[model samples]
Target: MYRSHTCGELRISHIGNTVTLAGWVQTVRKFGSITFVDLRDRYGITQLLFGEELNKQLDENPLGREFVVQATGKVNERSSKNANIPTGDIELLVESFSILNKSAVPPFTIQDDTDGGDDLRMKYRFLDLRRNAVKKNLELRYAVNRSARNYLHENNFMDIETPFLIKSTPEGARDFVVPSRMNPGQFYALPQSPQTFKQLLMVSGYDRYYQIVKCFRDEDLRADRQPEFTQIDCEMCFVEQEDILNMFEGLIKRIFKDVKGIDYTEAVERMTWEEAMWQYGNDKPDIRFGMKLCNLKFPAHTFPAKESLSSLIAGDFAVFNDAETVIAIAVPGCAEYTRKQTDELTEWVKRPQIGMKGLVFIKCNADGTYKSSVDKFYSEEKLKAIADAAGAKAGDLVLILAGTEERTRKATSELRLEMGKRLGLRKADEFKLLWVLDFPLFEFALEDQDGGGAGRWVARHHPFTSPKPAHIETMINNSPKVADLDKYLEHPYAGIKANAYDMVLNGNEIGGGSIRIFQRELQEKMFAALGMDAEEQQHKFGFLLGAFEYGAPPHGGIAFGFDRLCSILGGSESIRDFIAFPKNNSGRDVMLDAPSEIAEKQFDELSIKLNLK
Candidate 1:
């Protein structure tokens, strides 16, 4: 055997016990006659001392860093214990040793604080994984996985395997296609989620199903995103939205208790999608702090007897008054912003695709006076009214954005986050719970190949979503005139509401799922509403629709982002830290060099051609 006990198993009680241990050499310190070697493995590390006789052997056959070895030694109480490590209280007195394997000099030092850049570490990932910090991350990942499995098993959830090679559906993100060798010219796309299979499992009488599986998506990558990722996916039969939410909420609490020993027993807050966007400017709002945007309308004293909104709208500032919608925010205790700071805020809105023209600011002085870009356009009375409208107290600064209504609202929201960062209000560890409800059923993003120009309409969320029963009549009968630019008006399918819920944490959407349309007719109607032809529906979700015919139970479930959960738990900004082998920003596997040209023979067998652009 390579070892009798793990490196972590030895303690003071194991003194005088003859032990056989095996691990890679962590460090070697030689003191002429006596030599000390730190033997390390996944479990832990142990210090091994070689006496003078063995030291002479070591001179000829010297050990190097990361060299694998096996040793038989007598455990003894350490003469000088290290308080930092668990196995520090004991040491091994080596009697004999053998080199199991030798390692080439690693490109980078295998230290916790190794001086290696991201690209270098990724290229030599094997060596990088040997670092204590990297090993600890992997260990934490295992602990999380084990904890989730245990929780699911205890809750009577069955672990069912789903096919990785599955049919592709053209709905959301692009797919990673795999060419079929036997069936030439045909392809199989990877499972985005086990979405349809889990639903089918419900129909096949599996009351509960869960899989900690890999999901693929071909989309733009971010620090927290990857081309391939893992999820704690699950589905439950005969359950409502409340049932799924309560059950998964418990799962999260259990993970916290088991993994980090933190108890999140309190009920998580909920917010509608509409409210979340209106108040925080994003679907996944970071509720950790408050710098909420407040609406203020009307210009100054000389205009009308209306309340003044000089901070946002002014006679001279045509940007705000000219726009149909203008939004503003108040930043507390930052009334003394310098010209450089204000210029920076203006430049921020000019980033490509964000599409905001500029920003307006009003700094309310301590003595109730205000300094603003639109100050000349309004009197003192007008300034006070505008300040009051914005809920801006003395010593507070009010910021404003103006453009097209949608763009202005979006810009105002971005400004809140930016100012939050500058004010140190967006704390990661401090979680703020909220429930955003009451979302619109449909959103138009041009027609899906039906080609109706601005008159086209589609589901805001998805066609499977159930419309609010009260608004059903309005949605079905009314084809009212709606603006093309601001497409928030009533349409043929505007009243639907998916039985969906998203759990957001620390400004990141960690989980989202919806109660599916179980009825075949309803499903078909949904497809028809989305402009899918009968043939298209049959080709895409025909199997799913057929499964519903076999007495399928009403089911719903949510998938938790295992990586994002761990990232939040570990207090890291990027989820890649939790993922063992994550790809870089460009979706390239630095270690493996994937997405490369396949061998010509292999491509020919699959009847594939690489039309590289």
Candidate 2:
């Protein structure tokens, strides 16, 4: 046998026991007559001692870093134990050794704090994985996966495989297509998520089905996103929104306990989509801190019930009065901020990402005084009123942003998160879970249709999502057309809400799902609302619509972003590190050098030609 024990297996209890160990050389040190080497494997590292005689052998063989070696030795207690490692208490006193293989010097040091850039590390990812830091992330990822599977299996959810090569129905994001060689001219698109098949499984009488599946989307990449990613996809039959919520909440909590040892005893909080947007300016708000947005002035459509503060800023302040929205948040203990600090904040919002023209501020002084940038537009009393409306206390600074409704709200959200970061409020160790419900069933899609004549309605989630029970009639009866662009808010479809919910954790959307339309008529209507004609719907989703005609049950399910969830649990901001062989930000596999061109003969056999633009 190459080895009797792993590098990590020996301990003080095994002292004086002769054992064979095999691993890669991690570090080598010489102490005059004696030599020490650290042997590493996937399990752990163990120290090995080379006596004067064996030291001569090591010198002749000349062991280097990452050299694969096998050694037979007696386990002995270490003179200076390394408390940090599991195998610290004991080490191997080598009697004989063999160089199993030699290795070239790696491009980067195989250490946790390696001196390598991202591209360099990615190119040498195999060497990078040898680092303890990266190994721990993968280990944690596996633990989470195992925990989720165990929980789901206990809940009677069957693991079923789904097809990767399926029809291309371009709905939400672009699909990555694979050209078919067998059926020459046609192509197969990868499954974005197994949305249709899982529902079909429910219709086929499988009460509970789950899959730790790979999903693909041809979209822009971000820190949390990849062209191909995994999901903890699940579907259940005869379930309402409440049942799915409870079931998945249990799944997440069980994962927390098994992986992080966090009990998470507190009940997850819930808020309506409107409430989340109104209070925090974001659907996925970080509830660990409390800097809720205050709507000073906003459009009627945004917060239909709340009164606007037009009267308070109804002076020569054109920036506030003319803007479609004005919003603010109170930054505690920043009332004495210098002009330079405030200027820096102003520039922060003015960036193209935030897309705001300028920022306004109101300082609520400790001595019952008020100061503001718009002092010429309002008096001390009006400034105090504005600060009071924003929930600013004494010795607090109120920061405000005003512009178009969408831009202003988004900018305010980014600003709030930035301030939260600056104040050290968004802690990685602290996790807060929330559910944002009652999203709009349809979002105005002026940019989606050709010619941009008048915006057509598009499904906020998907065409399969059922509308809220009360709004079902409104959705069915009203034509999803806007006669006037200015009065689109008056359309009945604008008021309809979906039976959907998104689970947000620490300002990131981890999972979302909605009760599906079981009836063929409602499904067809949903397709029609999304601007799909009868023929187009028949071409794209005929299989699903046909299945619905038989005996589709009331099914609802959610898919957790498996990578994002794992990263969050591992206290990491990027999912790439948690993923093995992940593509870079440009969706290029640096190690494999994938997404490359095919041979001309292969392309011709597939009846394809590349037309580079």
Candidate 3:
């Protein structure tokens, strides 16, 4: 046998026991004639001692970092123990050793604190995985996976595999297409999330189904996004929204207990989409902190129940008065900020990403007086009123942004998140789970129109989503027409809410799902609302519509972003860190060098030709 005990298994209890161990050399150190080496494997690391006699053998065949070696030795108690590792109390005193394999020096040190950039580490990912830090992340990921599977299996959810290659029906994100060699000029698109198949399973009487599946989408990448990713996809028939919420909450809580040792005894919070947007300016609000947005002036249609403080900008501050929306948030204990600090904040909002013309501030001083950036326009009383409206306390700073409604609201949300980050309020370890529900069924997509004259309606989730029971008639009765561009918000279909919900963990949308439209008539109406005429709908989703007609049961399901969830549980911001052999930011596999060109013969076999633009 190559080894009797793993590098990590030996301890003081095994002292004087002769054992064989094999692993890669983690580090090597010399103390005069004696040499010490740390041997590492997937399990853990153990210290090895080379006596004076073995030092001569080492000199003849010197060992380097990451060299694979096998050694037979007597397990001895360590003279100096390393309390950090499990096998710290014992060392293997080597009697004989053999080099299993020689390795060229790695491009980067395989240490947790290795001096290597992202690209270099990605290129040598196999080496990087050997590091304890990366190994822990993968371990945590596996634990989560196991916990989820156990929970789902206990709840009678079957693990069903779905096809990876399916028809291309582009909706939200572009599809990654694979050309078919046998059927020339035809192609197959990768399954984005197995949405249709899961629904079909529900119709075919599979009451509970689940899959830890891979999904692909050709889209612009970000820190949280990838061209291909994993999803904890699930669907259930004869269930309502409440049943799904309770079931998935149990799943997440079980994962918390098994993976993170967090009991999470308290019930998860729930907020309506309107409430989330009104309070946090984001549907996925991080409830770990309290920096809720204060809507000073906003469109009447956006928040019908919210009353605007029109008097604050009554003094003709055109920046605030002329803007379609005005929003602010209080920064706790920042009233004493200097002009430089506030100017820096102003520039922060003016960046191209934020796209704001300027920033307005009201500093509620410690002495209860207020100082303002628009002091020239408003009196001290008016500034105090604005500060009071924003819930600014003594020694608080009120930051305001105003512009077009959409941009202003989005910018304010980004700024709130930025300030939350600055204040260290968005802690990765402090997880807060929330369910944001009742999203708009349809979002206006004017830019997606071909003629660029007026925008058309598009499914906020997808056409498969069922409208809220009360609004079902509203969607079916009204035409999805916008006679005037400015009056699009007044359309009857614009106000309809869907039976949808998103689970947010610390401001990131971890999962989402909706009650599906099981009725053929309603499903067809949903398609029509999305501007999909009969022919197009039949070509893209005829199978689904036909299935709905065949006694489909009321069903709903959710798909959690498995990678993002693992990262959050691992206290990491980058999902890439939790993923093994992940593609880089540009979706390029540095190690495998994938997404490369194919040979001419292969292209000819597929009857395809590349036409570079």
Judged by whole-model lDDT over C-alpha atoms, candidate 2 comes out at 0.91
Predictions in order: lDDT: 0.79, 0.91, 0.90
Model 2 lDDT tens row, 75-151: 99998999999999998999999999999998989989999999999988888999999999999999989999999
The candidate 2 region of ten consecutive residues with least summed lDDT is 445-454
List the candidate 1 regions with Cα displacement exceeding 4 Å: 297-312, 336-356, 433-435, 447-455, 459-463, 468-488
Could you give candidate 3's per-residue lDDT for residues 1-613 as a string of tens digits?
A: 9999898898778999999999999999999999999999999999999999999999999999899999999999887999999999999999999999988998888888899899999998998899989999999999999999999999999999999989998558788999998899999999888999999999999999999999998887888888889999999999889999999999999999999889999999999999998898878988998878888887775667566687776876888878888898999989999999999999999999999989999999999788999888999999888888888899999999988988998999999899889989888778899999999998887685433234888788977899899999998888887889677888898889999999999988999999999999998888887777899989999999889888999999999999999999988889999999898889999999988988999989989998999
Ordered from best to worst lDDT, the candidate numbers read 2, 3, 1
- In candidate 3, what residue range of length 10 has the lowest lDDT sum? 445-454
| Candidate 3: residue 112 Cα off by (Å) | 0.9
Q: Which stretches of candidate 2 lie over 4 Å from their true place?
A: 301-305, 449-454
Candidate 3 residue runs with Cα over 4 Å from true position: 449-454
Error of 3 at 109 (Å): 1.1
Residue 223, model 3: lDDT of: 81
Comparing 1 and 3 on TM-score, the stronger one: 3
